[model samples]
Target: MMKSKSKILVLDDDPNIVEVIVTRLESMDFNVHGFTDPGKALDALRKDSYCVLVTDQKMPEMDGMVVLREAKKIDPDVEVIILTAYGSIEGAVRAIKEGAYDYISKPFEPLELVTKIEKAIEKRELKQRVRFLEQEVGDSIEYRIYAESPAMKRTLAIARQVSDSDSTVLIQGESGTGKELIARMIHYESRRKRRKFVVMDCGATPPSLIESELFGYVRGAFTGAIKDKRGIIEEADMGTLFLDEIGNISPEMQTRLLRVLESGEFRRVGELKPKQVDIRVLAATNADLEAKVEDGSFRPDLYYRLKVISIKLPSLRERKEDIPGLVQIFLSEFSRKTGKKIMGIDKRAMNMLFNHQWPGNVRELKNIIESAVVLCKGTTIGPDEILLSGIREQKEENLNTLESQEKNLVIQALKKANWVQKDAAAILGISRRVINYKIKKYNIRPEKVN
Candidate 1:
């Protein structure tokens, strides 16, 4: 798909420089609007929303830094990148501290400028998404697992179809993919809807206490068992038990849980008699249980038993098309809670959101939007309102090609160094830290490099 281009606001007093940048960026598929006058560019800033604002450091009436500051007042979320000459490095750093996304040194490479611009746009979009989610999902009673993409629609359909069943279901996806919400939906829509639905995070509990907590104990069973207690399983007898982060369970806990699944019975501590319950099991994990099984961290039998039916939630990056809708919903939500009358997002901000690789998924998106809404002073959110400068640090791409540069570099290094970390780092003239980071970031296989 030809991804939608982010809008670029180019401000420079020199018509020639403005013309060159506009043609170059537009040729790269960006939507570019330029102004040779700082005042005119500020007018454009007030009238239109831009994903990125590129301005010259030294202008006739007003400097680029001054223009950028004013541009932020008009639209806080708009990303600003300054173009600085040789001696203006200090000024560029000051601009960065004042909220500019990046600075391009004069006489820079076309490729380098393009990479920085791409990163700036990506960072801006991430901020906008975070703002939208925070604003929309925080206060709504009709909370939905929002997904308009085909892949997400399919997953939602599967979730709905299996929600009413008594069978155990395993939800697999990366963290922030809304596994808990899916589990809640299943319980809410099931035959046991009116009964209590208890959640137990296997990953949170200490291994020593997981057994006593899940299958309670009699009075004086242990040091803290001064009174008789109802276990989580008993507490949720006619309801549903949500086992979150299921892959983190220890082998011993897995065995105990396995027995419960098989017999629907568990005995309290210090009691010989077994108690029977009719609770349904719904488990979720971001880990690959199958891979864990291969490595013996998880039991194969337990994995099979829990995964009678599995639903995998797609990552946020895999469903970029749904971002626009998600953003709107979040805006309304945050505006209500924060008492901010924020009305809408700038078109350019929305474009940036659709291009970001959201490593943190929906949860991260919600946090970003909430932060922006809290910090915003107007009815509309602009690019600078979102804090996404660090997002680019984690991106695997060259910020331009998404694939070419890093992939090729890793492959070449692996070939020359026989895939050894120290050797590869030496071949690339970078630290082992950088090499290791790249290897993981690109999911590169040294074994396959040759």
Candidate 2:
């Protein structure tokens, strides 16, 4: 039996014609629905999705032209085929002008109609694929970063400086520190921004398949290699390829990657000829490549090549000054996404966020905010809504030490506001009395603070 994923709608005023068309389509393994009334057909089109609309031109309630126009309105990608006993050059032209795929003459061969249906389905599928690609590009085309820290500021400055050049950049960081985010900033800010930005995770993929996945393969290159497939490297031609967890790649894969970096050429598995591609490579990892090299698990030559332009990102704890801004941004993001009205975080909750060491880093912070937003019933996110892993088990005294989150925030805000108690209070949105109390509590002596 023939196979298709297209859900076809067959509409003819005559019951016999509808039955014949539906039966033929179903026998060919097409998911077909039939309707004798134009009203019902249009209703179905409005309520459900149909890739192909087969409608009789002559109808009592509505003409096929009307159906064609309405179907297009419902789904511009829907391909309509007009069927009429009174087929004419004028009628066919009218149908085409009204957005019909094709006009069919009465008593036409079932095979001929089926062929047109198949062609229409192919066009519909092609349109969908194009739309998906366009959406992908549209969604992530911009590489703007709203970061709020000097640590990130320095990182981005380096990233922007290297974007114009085609040199390979190796970004070093603990996991969840937004290494990939920095890579995309470089890509979007570069000349090759119009092309694709393909991502491959070396740590997640098995070594046996990494070769085939990175370099692609021909049909029958191995078992289940049913068709020739272009690898990730080919897909990223004239674009950017970001290999995450680069240290996890096998030694054999490292040799192949080095060749690509040096020569700009690679061969698909089972293929004799090599395909030349121009691509800028960006690699990231939480592991230390130097240690790996020392242990002889990684290639030293490849390591040097990848480290041509190096960037080391700080862990979240090192950039604690950014927590307030990051938390507020994450709160707004998760609030909008979840349709929650949580507009702000309570001081204790914000303090809890600051207290955590954040082993998972910014990603963990974002997830925590998302969870808080989902669970928060009131407009503000309280400490009860904030579920921290280590806070509950840790003692209250440790949480409220002289070097605590609250004291640090007061100091930073004081420094930012030029040591004026009232201004610092304004910065932290607290009263002057509160700021003075905090200053005394944290032992803020002017000479020592300065």
Candidate 3:
């Protein structure tokens, strides 16, 4: 059985040109629709979904640029190619600036046209795949933790397996390693998903308020207690309670928390009656609880209770291979939020990203990408647009190296010249040929500007 071909729409004022394009596309296994009248071709576009559109620059009712605009309005993802005669090159360039996929000169070779079309289709497919990934992450009920590395995948698989049980989960990782995100994922995927998921940061709260904050308080329980109030634990009854930075709680609070975990019983401040509630606990910490236990800072019994099912998330450096995917997701997100048309990142910028040690982990990477998207003035991100002052400061010894210094100089020149290689060379007091050589040597590929 033969698979159906992708649909393509072709429009031109000359019937001969339209016939030639249609015949060539159809011979290459594309489902092609040809029309001499612009109105009819646009009508077809409005009625049917097409993978690509090939239109002539000049027409009676509409120009190719108008066709491109209308086609995009109908389907922003559709790839449009403009056909222009030799004298109408400017019009073709304008069409490209207005979002046409690519422009082909009239009297173009059949093979050349086919090759461009194939490339355009490939780009469209890539965009579709990125969109699918973004949708998958956005729609997930579990917290949005994007990862393509096997270590993180294995950790998530274990998380899914243990989510159905009421076992206390201890997520251990470095700061910004998304421990809190994992806690949320466990809560949403567990049986208590429908119930409230209350969060209490053990590290941020003061030692004096930890007890009263975890357990409810009665009127006159403390100087500020004017009325009865429920705490996070009571609010999380029949639900999940997430304790972030669990290693930071004092010894007394640990003992109290251990009792709650053991018997599901706790008493509000200034109250004698014991309150019982059914709740699951999820704890996370960037500190070494085992070391703390040995030092008598954290209780051994409490540590054991929290580690019933431990999950250790890999740091961003451990999963560097996932940076490209994460960058794409972040670029799309920031673009939509900021209303920027930033398409993608250049190869040189991506290499810099991969080389940097992300001490702040995924959180740091997301912030960097957001800043780049906001600062980027072109359709794509180049190395000059990426701001990594902290990372550079940490690697100050490497700054004096020839390659590093040269790379910095080249990035500065490119930024000042708006990425025009000729102008960038002039600004750097070098020949265009030398600049091109350095660009290739340093693997600096700036995004194309229309």
Best by TM-score: 2
Residue 251 lDDT in model 3? 81
| Candidate 1: tens digits of C-alpha lDDT, residues 97-160 | 9999989998777778778888887787668656654643454543577878998999989988
TM-score of predicted model 1?
0.57
lDDT value for model 3? 0.80
lDDT of 2 at 180: 85
Which candidate, 1 or 2, would have the higher lDDT against the true structure? Answer: 2
Supply the global lDDT for candidate 2.
Answer: 0.81
Over all chains combined, what TM-score does candidate 3 have?
A: 0.57
Model 3, range 341-423, lDDT digits (tens) per residue? 99899998888888876656777677678778888999999887875322242374655554565566667667757789997
Clashes of each: 20, 0, 0
lDDT of 1 at 198: 82
Off-target runs (Cα >4 Å) in candidate 3 are 1-142, 388-450
lDDT of 2 by residue, 1-450 (tens): 124546799999899999999999899989899999888887777644577999988888898888888889777889999887853658867898878888788888898899999999888766765664575456442233555678877887898899999999999997668888899888878987766788998866777889999999877889998856779998787789999999989888999999999998999998888877789999999888999999999999999999999999987888888888887887777777788887799998888878776655776676567667877889998888775211242455555642475666567667756788987776554467657877998898668867
Clashing pairs in 3: none
RMSD of 2: 16.5
